[model samples]
Target: MLLVLSDEHKEHLAFLPEVDSAVVGEFGRIAVEFLRKGSTPKIYEGAARKLNVSADTVQHGVEGLMYLLSESSKLMISEVDFQDSVLVLGFPEDLNRLLLQLYLDHRKEIRQILSELAPSLPHYHNLEWRLDVMLASRALRHQVKPTVSLKLHLESGGDHIARVLQTDPATLLHLIQELERALAEAKTNHCRRILRNIK
Candidate 1:
């Protein structure tokens, strides 16, 4: 998957070229630490003093690195794909290699941190559905109308929520078909690539 950096991120990371490779490595470490322990203004200030740059510039540079690593890890792109993704930044060969090495070294740990940070949401537990057919009515004799009733159960954080829904058979069938179509689309290569880049 190709990770496309936004123009703003590109501008923010532009300061990296002037910095030393060891400083870039330090920025990578700081980025990961920021993810795990939140931001530290004092450290940024100290780095800014050492690099003779503004604290805001140092902060933005670290943040840009964080965004790069996190997005690459979230997509789990292969090494070649990762190298290709960073190539757009127009960094020198050694800088690109350093960034790639940083990504490779911390991808797993970054993913773990991201997963922990993600919000917990309700998920499917069970579904119960019933079909009700009316064979006759006072207005319409010898007529059939089918309705579908559903009980959708969801579980979140050890708590269960149940929802009741009712719809005509035609509408229910349409919804089912639409959902199936969506599932099929999600499995396509084009859709996968779009989704990967979306992250």
Candidate 2:
């Protein structure tokens, strides 16, 4: 997402010890005011009148803000158009892609799973499945080996129909894949049973 900061917001950042507050405050009021209005046109005279500071002071303070923002890792000023006078600041494309993947894994994964399951749900009543996919705790005991467990609840009452545990990470993946194939077979058999009863 593009980074948009208000003139008042920039002024608040002036509190950082490295920036001179007097200069930041004046420049934020005058020069940043023009930038906030959606253009970066030179406004030395207008800023000077608003802040009661010399045009040179406003210019110097704004330069300081630009320098500080340039050094920031969180945001980058991609373009500074001297001709039309505009500033475009945003996250770099690589960083944006990384953030998007993280968002998909953490926030959108469950919704995606549900969407994938939707088409198969209407064939029978009370057809629900719960998958408790969890990681092992970090704390270790002397003889206890680290293991991953998957508990599958194939019915509505929440009774776990199948529980699989494997100590090796590579083996655990294979176990889960086999269990998923078995689950698909079980679901198909269940649908056949429903159709037989109807006939």
- Stretches of candidate 2 off by over 4 Å are 1-41, 74-199
Error of 1 at 175 (Å): 4.5
| Candidate 2, residue 52: how far the Cα is off, in Å | 1.7
Candidate 1 at 51: error in angstroms? 1.6
Give one digit per residue, the lDDT tens place, for model 1 in 1-199. Answer: 6888999999999989999999999999999999998999999999999999899999999999999999999989899999998899999999999999999999999999999999989999999999998766798756577888999999998999999999998898899899999999999999999986677
Best by TM-score: 1
Residue pairs of candidate 1 with colliding backbone atoms: none
* Clashes in predicted model 1: 0
CA lDDT of each prediction against the hidden true structure: 0.94, 0.43
Candidate 1 displacement at residue 76 in angstroms = 1.5
